[model samples]
Target: MHKIEELKIWKKSIKLTMLVYQLITALPSNEKYGLISQIKRSSVSIPSNIAEGAGRNSNKEFKHFLSIANGSAYELHTQLILTIELGLISKEKVQPVLDLITEVQKMNYSFQKSLETKISILNTQS
Candidate 1:
């Protein structure tokens, strides 16, 4: 089985999750169950899905989970934009996390493509 912790995308997603939590703390208490909750869940899903996918036995399964994680990344990205628009946090404070999310998205996309290639090769050989 692959080591999820060793994956660069996993590590970066973890970092993004951490930054999201930190940033959320500064938001108003009224948002505790609103944008705050949604943001936190989506942020956490990115890494959690990656780890879960890594534990799967097949490349196809892993790739499927990566797609889910990618979706969560986009969801989080949208929520982050909403937070900025709502004035929950300053752009400067959230920029680093946004940047990290973009990096994770790119890495996830590349990794998924690599897995697809591997799967295609296996299919051809069979």
Candidate 2:
């Protein structure tokens, strides 16, 4: 993509972050700083890292950033599960968020693989 903001992955990540923010708003007052903070940070990291990585000059660096973004995505996914288990959110309430996360994860994986291929070609060229 010419611009990080133009990438579908980035757009999806933004949507996912917004969804998480909405979900956390409904959390108990006590968790406003605990689970709430953690979830928001992790969710935001997904898109933020993607944009940061896309700004890098090298494909390798971009791939590294994408990897970090993927890691953050998994972290958010884990937290969502924890939220369900802790009774902080019902399975129904969390389902839409989970679906969005899954979609973003799949897109990230596809983009990562594409980056890997491009990087391999670039390495060969050099």
Candidate 3:
């Protein structure tokens, strides 16, 4: 198992989650049970999945969790864009969060590829 605390992706995602939380607090109360709720879940899922994967017995399992986290990041991206289009939050307020989510998604893709390479190597050796 990998040490989650040492992973830059996990750390960055944690920061993303915190920033998202801070950003969403200013959203409309009516969205409390709608877009706001989804945004919160997706943001938390990113880092939470990373931590979960890190505790697994194998890299494959970790990669699966990372994939889930990446999916959550995209879900968050879509929700953020929707919030902007709906005028629930201004683009200026949501832009930074979107940028961070993009960064997390790219990092996740790269990390997943690295894990895939490692898995391939192990398979070839076996």
TM-score of each: 0.97, 0.96, 0.98
- Arranged by lDDT, best first: 3, 1, 2
* Candidate 1 Cα errors over 4 Å, as ranges: none
Candidate 3 C-alpha error for residue 74, in Å: 0.4
Off by over 4 Å in 3: none
In order, the Cα lDDT scores of the candidates are: 0.93, 0.90, 0.95
Per-residue error for 21 in candidate 1, Å, reads 0.7
- Model 1, 15-72: lDDT tens digits are 8999999899989999999999999999999999999999999999999999999999
What is the alpha-carbon lDDT of model 3 when measured against the actual structure?
A: 0.95
lDDT of 2 by residue, 1-126 (tens): 349878999999999999999898878989988888999999999999999998998878888888999999899999999999999889898989999989998998998899899988988998
| Decoy 2 TM-score against native | 0.96
Expressed as tens digits, the lDDT of each residue in 47-125 for candidate 3 is 9999999999988999999999999999999999999999888999999989999999999999999999999999999
Local lDDT at 68 for model 1: 99
Indicate the residue-level lDDT of 52 in model 2. 94
Ranking by TM-score: 3, 1, 2
